[model samples]
Target: MKRANFIFICADQLRYDALSATGNRVAHTSNIDRIGARGATFHGHLTPNQICSPSRATMATGLYPRHHGLWRNGVALDERLPNLWQALSRAGYVTMGVGKLHFQPLLAAAEREMPESLAYWAKPGSERWRGPYFGFDAVELVMGEANESTRAGHYAAWLRRNHPEVVDLYEPEASPASRAEDLKEVWKSAVPPELHYTSWIADRAVDFIKHQSNRPEPFGLFVSFPDPHHPFAPPRPYCDLFRPERMPRPTIRAGELERMPAYLAEGDDPKKDPYIASGEQPREQGFLLRTDDISAQTLAIAIAHTHGMVQMIDDAVGRLLEALAGTGVLEDTYVLFTSDHGELLGDHGLLRKGPPPYRQLLQVPLVLCGPGIRPGTSLGALTSHIDLFATVASLLGLPAPATDGIDLKPLIEGRATAVRDFLFAEYHPRRDACLYNQSVITKDWRFTRYPNEPAWGELFDLSRDPWEHWNLFSESEFSSQAHRLNSILDQGLPPQPLIPNEVLGAY
Candidate 1:
């Protein structure tokens, strides 16, 4: 029963109220609030897909992107399903990943321009090509943002081998253009903060936990932090760490998009979308359709550069937990921290994320911490993100993974209180069919719908409108709780069977 030793990280788009132990009074994530003050903090987790490669292909195949087919964002994950990094590398562990594993499909790595050629690890004896790819035996890849245009992989070959004079500030014809007419919401990066890319993903995840600390198997790593998502760039002293008149601001109601769901109150039009009109603000348009054409001091300088990119990923999660307590493996390790969905910083008046399933884009920001967990616990039940692949295959005793996500380790060790009474999400529409949608939150309603406009939907009673600003889906006394949560999204999540890569051979 050795097991225990994972890492997980993940950041891109953050927003579970932008932390500070989830009470975020303008971001000061004391190292992600010390992992919820040392373990377990699900505050209703969610995010089965609110975009970003289909919620990171449902946390790498714990299914549900309609059975992990990646239903949107240039879809891809069908490299024969079964994932969680090849089931923790066939159980011997030691898997690895560095940053932004949007599990393939950032516009197919810019139509295979293979990130400005460093592909195949700069060839000529391809040094063991480092990766069993999706099941990631090893991978470093990084794409987009910080001088955009899919910012070349291997973090631009480790910024052309250790910051070759600011590796041409991440290219795009040697950067320099964003004069903020909304280049996706903000910008400033001239590449600093020790040559950014979130400091090369926390120095390659503290050099892969100092090269897998005395390796005798058991290791998992995943680090991945593509910033407080968007061109909201943050560098140098975390770009003036928060002070847009002391943060908060973005809620903006005013006829709340006429009670939402006219395909998100008729928003889409990032200049007639071609993926939001090809980067760096191509004649701006989707801050939920120009939230009355931006301004509250440009959404308070893009929420004060997204609270200085979440305090530069909470100071790279306090230097990867001080490199796992300086390689003593920080009490056998388990870590977790989350994000792969969330960002609308402007709430109902929107700023990012689409097809509004709101709750600031499907909640996100679970915590976790190590071994037997439970310290300072929080768990408001209703979890998701495919329950972190069945709570890391039930903390390594294995089995679980054919998918619809369940083992949240008995609801984070308090021996369960709730794992599901309702919490589902989906948005399968790559390139607008009005951004297709579906949702359900329950434990006080949140609804959503829109199967191609089922008379347009959304309900939100979230325990008396938790900032949803009222919709009541054409209320008539909440129409039998929106037809019993649309019949639990029409009896979904039950039919997972596909792990058969052949056997029984004596034919």
Candidate 2:
């Protein structure tokens, strides 16, 4: 069989229910839906970690955050670690990334106040500058939301050259006086659709495909879109695409947090908690938007903008697909669409994601399309973002890396009913003490436990309460089930060597 080219696209902080295919009436994601229609959609896919850098590290290395040593947002990946792109490249595939490859934490340099290790890509003439980052032979990166001052890399350089007038919009500004008013639910970027980061990612991805279509070797392109995350600002028509009145409000019970673990319950106060601090303070300065007390109208507007961002990404996906078809590689290319993690979206009175093990923050959308894939199929098999490494390696006939994720090709080809019986996810806190939690999800239940605080945890009978309205951890009726799930977590991650035996054999 001939090896197929690969195009992996991911959106930042996109949730499982954001797609129209998921019966989301508010967000019209026709392009993403088309991918699902043409391939298999894994409905039970979950992320390994809930943050940007750690989850992405798992995707790249096929190892959990702990093993990879990037358990937090501000840590950098050990360059010596085995990378999926490096394997593909060694197998004679051209590797390229278009946008937002958060292999390194977003504000690492700024937060640590380092001089040599700048957070963004190095300048063209810098002595330490180099390409083929983290196994990617070429990378174009952009950090933060549309108006983020920290935005840099090829995207920033492109804006300076092509749209100099709007470059100032992305420049860093002073932190706002208070976060009480800025909840990150809704905002409008002065940037138009054509100049937006989503548009830039699509433009570069299409260009790369066009440039490499006639190459002798197969190519692997990672087209990443940084949007729908926060500062909920979508440009122009997209900002107005979803009306606030028509969007669904967050699922909030009167006292949902009352039942939560003590650590999680404390997040109910934005003024006291740092994680939920509204984006009024710059991330470099260590402040997050508080989602605890947002009003119904603000939450609705945020949802509308989030949907609009999804729509913009969907449109960009449409353009990239068109480029593939135009280049005559559409038939032979394999396309995978997913996200790093999910947003809280006002679910359970939370606006952003943190240590919580709620489904809204853990579950993500996974769509696979191309040759050998069953079209219009939905698989409920448990899958994780880490699985992409093994699956892609298998698809390309490359040597598999040491990974905790299993090969999902069987599930994608309809050859298996399920891949794994249970899925595990984790979050490690760096700045805050409360933001540390691990979860185990089985066919009928979701259980979470915190380190050093065994008595304080979460247990939900997902089969009965999918919304996770009740906590069963403290109830005696469900004590046995909780114990069993906790046992599974105690066993720890599946066996995965830090260095694959094959790589060692090369010595």
Candidate 3:
């Protein structure tokens, strides 16, 4: 076995633009920035299936959403596929997944959130909770990201119930108003508890690194953190870190809906306008879901609070780094920090995730730092999260497994390379009865196919319109480009596939 090990850190729903190294000013991510300075950073990284379960399954199997059959959340990954963890384990590597294994092995607790319409619906088996995930030696999970009301046997609650001092040593703070919406009862209750969830997870990781010794060889630890996801609840200090007045707001145009396809605005049951004009305040006329109750500054607080959550996550990352160094496993570990997907904070009149694929939820940040990696370098080539498994394999000198994701080692090593020419992502319920959306992105262009034929479809040139406000699907100039990208859609993708919606619009 190779003497080196791997430490992977994942931030839940962390946007690519939220990192200071990536030009996000409103927030701070010093630990991530330090890692970027030590190794290579891919600014163009993306998740083919940009959601929690699907993208994480992609990361595990090194397969595309089509190949893995985990194209949607709350669905099971095809059992037939051989994953990186399993392969590495067989090849004499110590593979231990530390956090957030979103793969749906069974329909029980952790996997319960998966919709029944998806395939391979079953309950989480003994292997789901028991260690050696696919191949990892140990796994202490925090039940697919939980809160007070929906505590799903997560690691934090486990620690709080048992080992609370670990948190005190690393993060001795109270997360005021960091509870779930349903847990508002506990939000204002007494002196806020000492250990927060994010820190608790990190504290457990530190203990695991220092104590766990069952592995016979070097380890590859998937240190996953389900932070900055939903609830937007960082503790009191972090929660109030940023003021909304200083944060930037979206620049909406009057003709925004005119450029977009009609179906995008079709789901407005309350008769709200599909698009909000520039300089106009957001109206609650069914334009968006999720953000049901909004006072004037509530939206602003949500934005600021989201950034605050990100900053809190940043501090947690620092603690993890300190643990790695303290454990005397610093140089021997190949560290990877990334997110399953980005969070769309008020982009496209959207609040939280699901229901659609906005840029705020699609584009994620990827920073890889360790031996043999170039520091502070950015690859302009487009990439996808499915490439993670293969990249890990390459770093360990293991053969790339049979999967749809491309091995990004060449691009990361500063080799100007040809990675994925065109990337595609899928979302919706995995079960047959549920509908979904498919998005195709090329270097310059993007096309989204909506299931159930919503209001309209979206097409944009990311190079020209990073905000993705312009819908160029109706433009005749890109007819050939659209066809060319569509041809590479991998017809023999994975196994059973989610049906792609036919868009009948102007172009």
Candidate 4:
């Protein structure tokens, strides 16, 4: 068996049901679904964290957030950590990372600049800067999420240099009224599809694959798209693809938060909360949006816009597959698609991510297709984002470094039916910060506990309430079940961080 090329495509904030293959009736993801047709889709896959940096760090190092020490969004991932791309590079694979690789803080100050930060990339001669970053031999990065006005990275530079006329089209205030909808944070970008960041990322990856096809060594390409994350702005025709009327209403049960945890009962005002006001996340937008007060129309429009973004990403995925097929490496390359984390999408009357990790925020889509992978299979065996490093290393016949993840090779190849018995996920407000919460998800139950406030917790019977509308934490009838799950959580906890938490910037 020869070493195979790997094209790992990741999307930020893409939920489990975003793909048509994954039971999304509204989103047309034909290209992404093709991978599932050619391989398997892991329906039980869950992200280890709710934020970008921590979850992405888990993918890179195969270590949970607790073990990695990047407890929040703005913290930088330790470069010394043994990462997946570095392992591939060591095994003679040419490694390249394109688009949003949020391994570090994007809003870091100039004094403490990082490759992933806007401050570092905005400097002179930064255009010539590529990786050796977090194991990738080369990188073509795009900083920030959907908003392009403040974006920095190679993609932003390209937009400014070649497509100056369309730069203002990305700004919400400058966008023509007709081009955008009446709803806030939902718009049809006037920027052409070819020049959008989503397309730019695909274009770079396709070009790299075409060039690498002529080379001797197998290549590992990390093509990450920052879209479908937030702002819900899709380019041109994609933005008009979905209608609000056709979109599904959010799964919000009245008084859902009041029954669960006290902290979740009320939305946080960034101006009032000390942690959020001083935290790394941009204060202008507020840490988390309050969806409870928003009208149903707004929620529908948001979902519709989100579906449009998903469509654009699907088209981008189509282009990547075409590149692989055109280069004659389609059979020799493994194409894996996943997300850093998930968006709440108005689930439980919550908008955006943070606090009270629901299934909508924790479950992410995982699809794998390549040599030896079973085609058209959908496996429900529990899996984690941490499993990718070990699985990839096994596929390439390389010795994997010590990691918290287990190899999913047997499961994907149809040799086994299950990988792990349960999954664990966590979130922290800041580096070395308290008010942290952890959840243990078993086959039948999902239990979350906040270590800081031991009395406040969430417990749901996944087998009975898949949407998690009912919180069984304080219910005496389900106390025994909660106790069992709590024990599992205690036993399954990973080793504490050995390194001190380093503060880099506001997230």
- Candidate 3 per-residue lDDT, tens place, 69-175, comes to 66554346654578877767777766666556666522323233432111112233322444544567666665433243123444544555576543332221243
Please state the error at residue 215 of candidate 4 in Å: 1.5
Whole-model lDDT values for every prediction: 0.71, 0.74, 0.62, 0.80
Off by over 4 Å in 2: 109-130, 170-185, 268-292, 493-507
Best of the two (3, 4) by TM-score: 4
Instruction: Score candidate 2 by TM-score against the native.
Output: 0.89
User: How well is each residue in 1-507 modelled by candidate 2, as lDDT tens digits?
Assistant: 447999999998998998988768777788898888899888898897777877888888888787787766656677889988888888888989877876664444444422123443454543234266777887777655666523456666677667888876443232121122545324566676798889988988999999999888899999989887876777778877888898887787777677887655444333333322223332211123345567777778778878888999999999999999999998899899999988888777776676776888778999989887878989988899879899999877789767988998888877898888898887765444444677889978998887656567899988888878778788888889988988898797532213221110000
Clashing pairs in 4: 280-506, 280-507, 281-507
Model 3, residue 421: distance off in Å is 2.2
Worst 10 residues of 4 by lDDT: 270-279
Runs with alpha carbons beyond 4 Å of true place in candidate 4:
148-150, 178-183, 268-286, 431-434, 494-499
TM-score of each: 0.35, 0.89, 0.79, 0.94
Instruction: Please write out the lDDT profile of model 4 over residues 2-56, one tens digit for every residue.
Output: 5899989999889998888889888779999999899989999998888888899
Question: Total clashing residue pairs per candidate?
Answer: 2, 9, 22, 3
Worst 10 residues of 1 by lDDT: 498-507
Q: Arrange candidates by TM-score, highest first: which order?
A: 4, 2, 3, 1
